[model samples]
Target: MKNTLSRLKYLYRKASRAGADYYNAPYRAAIARARREEDDLFMLLVFSEMMGIPNPAGWYCMELQPLMLERFHDWHTRMGMERSPLDNFRCC
Candidate 1:
């Protein structure tokens, strides 16, 4: 796992363009892992990437980021989590 993340970091640094090489492959895995850990960071990365938002980490950055994020949120809500952050962070 450490090597995987290290490889990702190396690739990220070696990458030329920003949005062009958003995610390779392991980065996607890292994002999925990250999602299981936290909702805010995961959603933020997914939403930002799907909307073409620039992210240096390139972690939650894939063409299907939007769909995955939606599914993740749905699953989370179904599991009894709140979704009030969409309207206002303060509300949650």
Candidate 2:
């Protein structure tokens, strides 16, 4: 009886997870797009100085450069630039 109850509980949990995933499938693409846009905005904020844009939070954003540099190439390309916008930094 204990084993049967445990098995039933496991099945119930599995079914719940599957159901949730199925329900969320339609919105998955929208969620992914929104997340990507948010990241792109964050990258822009971090690299705004390099792109010739004056960043109001430049002092605070300076600390984030090293961490965000790796994604700089992708971000600039996505923004329709053929090459790195920064004269000092070239990635591509």
Candidate 3:
């Protein structure tokens, strides 16, 4: 778990520097159905801190699938591998 956490830290650093966001658009449409509350904001701040970004001035369960997909795509592309849909292991 420690190794995974450390690896995640590296990925988070890379992602943050690349301007990735948990609150990106597809995420917003999924999770921001209502006004963000206090606890939600706290989680955002924590995530922001872990990713080494400025504490989000706020919080919002964010529908996380889209950004997750985007990241997979981004990584695949950057690797110069042929992009695949990652669904049932099909080609993209």
lDDT of 3 by residue, 1-92 (tens): 99999999999898886675644756775555443344344433433533456644423313443444434444445446675524443335
User: What is the lDDT for 10 in model 2?
Assistant: 100
Candidate with the larger TM-score of 2 and 3: 2
Compare the candidates by lDDT and give the number of the best one: 2
Which regions of candidate 1 fall more than 4 Å away from where they truly are? 1-37, 57-60, 63-92
Per-residue error (Å), model 3, residue 65: 5.4
Task: List the candidates ranked by TM-score, beginning with the highest.
Answer: 2, 1, 3
TM-score of candidate 2 against the unseen true structure: 0.78
Error of 1 at 51 (Å): 3.9
Residue-level lDDT tens digits of model 2 in 16-46: 9999999999999999899989999998888
What's model 2's overall lDDT? 0.89
* TM-score of every prediction relative to native: 0.25, 0.78, 0.22
State the lDDT at 87 in candidate 1: 35
Please state the error at residue 11 of candidate 3 in Å: 37
Candidate 1 structure quality by residue, lDDT tens digits, 5-66: 99999887777455455645548788776766686556667556434678776663655455
